[model samples]
Target: MTDVSSPIDTRWFYALVIAGICLNATGLFTPILEPDGALYACIAKTMAQTGDFVNLYAVGRDWLDKPHFPFWVTAVSYLIFGVNTFAYKFPALLFFLGGVIYTYHFVRLSYSWLTAQVASLILLTAFHGVLSNSDVRAEPYLTLLVIGPVYHFYRVFLGARFYHIVLGAFLTGCALMTKGLFVLVPIGAGLVLHWMLTNNWRELLKLRWYVAVVLSFVFTMPEIYCLYKQFDLHPEKVVFDNTNVSGIRFFFWDSQFGRFFNTGPIKGAGDKFFFVHTLLWAFLPWSLPLYIGVGNVVRSIVKRIEVPEYISLGSGLATFLMFSLSGFQLPHYLNIVFPFYAVIAAQFLVRLKPTALRRWTIAQTVIGVLLVVLIVGVLVVVQPARQGIALSLSMLIAVATFVFFRNTTLLSLVGRMVGAMLLLACMLNLFLYPTFMNYEAGLAAARYVNEQPQRAKRITALYGPSTFGESSWSYEFYVDGPTQYVRDDSVLQQLAGQRSVQVFTTNIYADSLQSRGFDVSPVAVFPYFHISQLTGDFLNYKTRTSTLKPYVLVDVRK
Candidate 1:
């Protein structure tokens, strides 16, 4: 751990401050329809095409499940950037930037600049961040905005400026609009625990506190009103109570709390061990030290000791417990909270005893190396035959690198090894992983259809979700002509009525289409079929196995 020698001064803050910004910008210019990037990008595109932001439509229907903040951001970006991969993912980069800047400020103000730098590094490199990758929306933006109030509240309590309270409340309202009712468990629980445990009873009735809550609701009224107008105001046309019932009420009430208590729109099937286990992989390399730091806090809390430890410990406990209790658990949920905890964890490292540092470094290095090896092995197995030779050579090099790292007789060298492994993971993301594994073939296939002058393919359609998002949409937008998304045998025959129109579908579904009409030939099977990274990086990065590669050109015509 670096000492506080320079970090406390303005020189340290100014000298290396832009590192996160530059690193974030490094990958920004490429890929838009990422991490559900295309989905939101389409919404923004649709908005630009139709000139409507209030009525969110996708592939010709109202798209629910997520709030409007992301679409709003993308829609605006589309107007400026003009709809491309970079434009599509623009919002994510911005929000991610927000998270980085805020995280640095919070750490420096609450802890120290050196601690802030270390914590920022942890945030930048976590595998979880890599998984969600990028998409501009409430999730990423809120990840940044969430700490505003929490951070300011801490500053206020320490008897600092009152203006920050207003700023925090304003940001809280914005976050609520971004994603409704998510803060109750994390922020609410942390605050309550803080007040109760600290016996700060008088602070509870502070007028400014109540005022802040009111201001948050007021600032966020537009989004809330939009929901009410669409669902509640028009019960007949907009809202329907089918088996999949419109739980507008539940979306507000049961969706969040129901899961919190394991009751409403979703069930509480999640295990208490879920997050604890998830963190081991999601926040890798940093996870080991964080565990020790939080563990120490837990022991101290049990004995009702360690006043200074309470803030970080209480925060970690509240966040971990919130996820543990919820039925709907995902990795990114931990992202917003981990920055605070990373500071706590970083503090532990900075204040480490020599022997403790040595042991911790060794464990992290071993775990890091093993994890990388396992990941590479999986990649090797899934590699296309074309990539097999390249993968083999790379693995041999990685093996040599691994062996060299293992001979860590020196303690300082061991810590450096963990850092080296971190860089390896980053390099893997930047170069190797993109080449060997990618879901962008859907996009590639989309382009291929556009370039053909013959119109040899009449019916253009997507085999699956990859089709629904940018792939099929891109096919429709640019693929020589209008391409409709297809699902079954009947559409295949209609599209191909007399002329031979090309079609695509999931391998299993494509079989049925062949039975009904013309010729079903395999053109290009994306054997390593997977949905676009647009969704996977953020939504379900871990569920890497279930991907869809529609064997291309499998169709039936005349």
Candidate 2:
């Protein structure tokens, strides 16, 4: 590594650290006017508007797609920031910061200060961080929880500082609160793997992992009670087969393991390579390093390094492999692995000299700027959107760009990687995010629904985003009203046998509704989407632009 680990090097290193993180926050945080963020926003707004925080609501009913921690955070943010996009992003920021700070400290314990800085930067700006910031979801918060336990345990595991172990357990509990049991998967896998690989089962006996288990459960009790009180206590008031749904049961059994087994609410075909490829974008600048790190660890195992340093690499690979093998996968699932990568990458990067770091910085900067240009270029050319660019085929370009970081300057790979991420973030917020997010048709359709001349007490979707669950929560978001969810079975059913329904959907769904003799007209229109895996593929009959041309207004109240 470089002499940059000297006193002056520490100063310059921290300077880069602060600069990298802040630049990332500023550049990547330009919120897109996408409905997904707004979907969360609207739910939080409903909580604030109606003074009901006990349960989540969408289109004026219980929304079960996600648990409530993210909602609580957003609701509190709405209360403080008064309902803005940044408010939705605020908690995620705190969680991500937790990941960065913990990684910084954790890496410092294992490697030189310079490497620690690079690793922290990787955690903040790399794959998961970039896209995660844009979408503002529950994953970022969960990432912090996932890392906290492992980081603390690493300290305890290596140094016998038992205090960190308790703290880690508490953070693991918080991760449970943030999203459920996922907080434990990484920590548990890492610990078991570390023990087996290092032949240190004797060390494991003394750490009192049971104390952690107890404390994490103790900390998680309130969340469990709240979930039970809402879902189990009041079953009839629930929807989506609410009578059979048990929130507590989900916490203990279904939400975690069932999903892995394809028995949960979200089921999909698994690709063993899903995570391998998703990591290309989800774990950015560090993606390549992790590639090297994983390979190195396997090689070390083959060579039988028999060292603790090699064990760290093994622990990382353990978590990575477990997540990959699980039946369920999402791009952001690999986020927690960054801390492991950070430690390894820091070891690799800080070993370089100052001049090498400088060249690394320039290379990273060049790659990042090029990424921004590509993303911006796509928004300009294909699927132009406004408010913030909505998710697009264009964004697939940005995803591809992050993968290219693997090829940039290897000398100070961390610097170049961080540099590219920082640049990409700047370009997105300053130049692109604001332009592309508006293509999401849900918000526009919601707005139009809210502005009906003679406001109705209820709204419906005959064929799209039934009620406000998916496409049009913005209607309730903008309107002084609540929406009702209803799906039409026979669009042209006889009026004498039909119930008059006030429906909102893409213009295409309206045609079938028109045949059923409802008073249908164009209420509003916005962009639409068709994803085969996203549940939207059922609406494959229409193009987003075509369906979005006119959101159908139907008076199905027979």
Q: Number of the top candidate by lDDT?
A: 2
User: Candidate 2 lDDT, tens digit per residue, 1-558?
Assistant: 232453224654575577566655663345434456657778788888677877777755566666677787778877898765677777777778877787777666655565666667667777567667667767778767776787787777777677887898888877787666765666677677777787877865763788878888898887777778877787676556547577788777677777678787666666778877887766665555567656655676788864345434655666667666767777766666667776775565555456765665565556555666665554445433341433433355345435644443432355445555655565556554443335445555555555665653444543553444445654545544455444545542343145555666666677765666555655455555421122222222233344334455555543
Residues 376-424, model 1: lDDT tens digits: 5555544433455545544664565465445433323223333434444
Every candidate's lDDT: 0.59, 0.62
lDDT for model 2 comes to 0.62
TM-scores for the candidates = 0.78, 0.79
- Model 1 CA deviation exceeding 4 Å by range: 1-38, 134-138, 160-162, 237-251, 258-269, 307-311, 367-422, 436-441, 453-503, 507-511, 517-528, 531-549, 554-558
Task: For candidate 2, give the lDDT of residue 6.
Answer: 39
List the lowest-lDDT window of 10 residues for candidate 2. 530-539
